[model samples]
Target: MQGQNGRGTDMPPAVSVRLEVIKRRSDFLKAARAQRRGMPGFLLQARRRASDEPDPSAIRVGFTCSRKVGNAVTRNRAKRRLRALAREILPQLGRPGWDYVLVGRPGATVTRDFAAMREDLIRALRRIHESPQ
Candidate 1:
């Protein structure tokens, strides 16, 4: 049997971990001051939520692309790519009660190979976790 896009109907859909999007400007600022891991394709900023914060069980994430990345279309495309990368990687590697921000690089994020970007994420996460908090 064929599924929606011609894939086999028997194949189960991808299971992604629950995540909350960070919307407040303050939250992004907080992450900006917290731990950061720089990769070739993106910069990851992560911060552990304080005990006083709400949604202690939620994993929060945000995406941003500056004008330096390019025009509206280019920035949007970069954010989209960052979102896709986060969706695929964060579920398994992300820590609960933490916020993550993926900052798009000017030339790398939009042009880097996806597999290379994935590798970059893996390494970045490892470094972030290994560093002193």
Candidate 2:
């Protein structure tokens, strides 16, 4: 079977990425107050964890979609896309000891082309890292 890139799909890649997700609402709220970068498809919230925080070497991430995004199905779809974007980009680009959040837009998050969204995420991350605190 051919994959999306027209490659064979007999076996999966050997890479195993361990992604740590932020679960508590407090963590999300904390990220909300931190630096944010807006893109065509979504908003990125990121901050470095304090020295006293646990898992200093881990890259943690979170995803959120508000009711304005849509109903339950639409919101879930947006979150899923954000998760995919984070998984693909964060492992390589994310800074250790930082907590990152991906917030979905009303129309853009659900309707935007995925490749464009991927590029937006990459740019957003770069902006977040390069700008002063």
Candidate 3:
């Protein structure tokens, strides 16, 4: 099948990433604070920056897994899973004006189902954006 650019569907979609996903620091602190929300499977935190702030158009995700999750190897595994999940969902679910930080929990997060983790993140973000404080 052909795509918008007349490219083959076998080719990946040209992702339209926004700077809000990548910018590390900025002045939209209120937006970030307002957007911070959490769920059972994961913790979600966000910070908003100025609308005109210059930022790279790529998704920048921060993952944190403490000793509670496991040793180095377990932490790394959990992080990798989170990263994969973020890559799949961020482009579609993430807001262009916020930064997200996902913190990993201990037992459940370490052995939790992979697909469930992805869905949790997506659901969490959707709720955050949908609610107005």
Compare the candidates by lDDT and give the number of the best one: 2
The residue-by-residue lDDT of candidate 1 on 77-100, one tens digit each, is 999999888887777678888899
TM-score, model 2 to reference: 0.87
Q: Per-prediction RMSD in angstroms?
A: 5.4, 4.8, 5.9
TM-score of candidate 3 relative to the true fold = 0.70
TM-score of each: 0.87, 0.87, 0.70
Clash totals for all models, in order? 0, 0, 5
lDDT of 3 at 95: 59
Models ranked on lDDT = 2, 1, 3
Query: Candidate 2 lDDT, tens digit per residue, 13-96?
Result: 423556799999999999999999999899999999998999898999999999999999999999999999888778767888
Candidate 1 colliding pairs: none
Better of 1 and 3 by TM-score: 1
Question: How does model 2 fare in lDDT?
Answer: 0.87
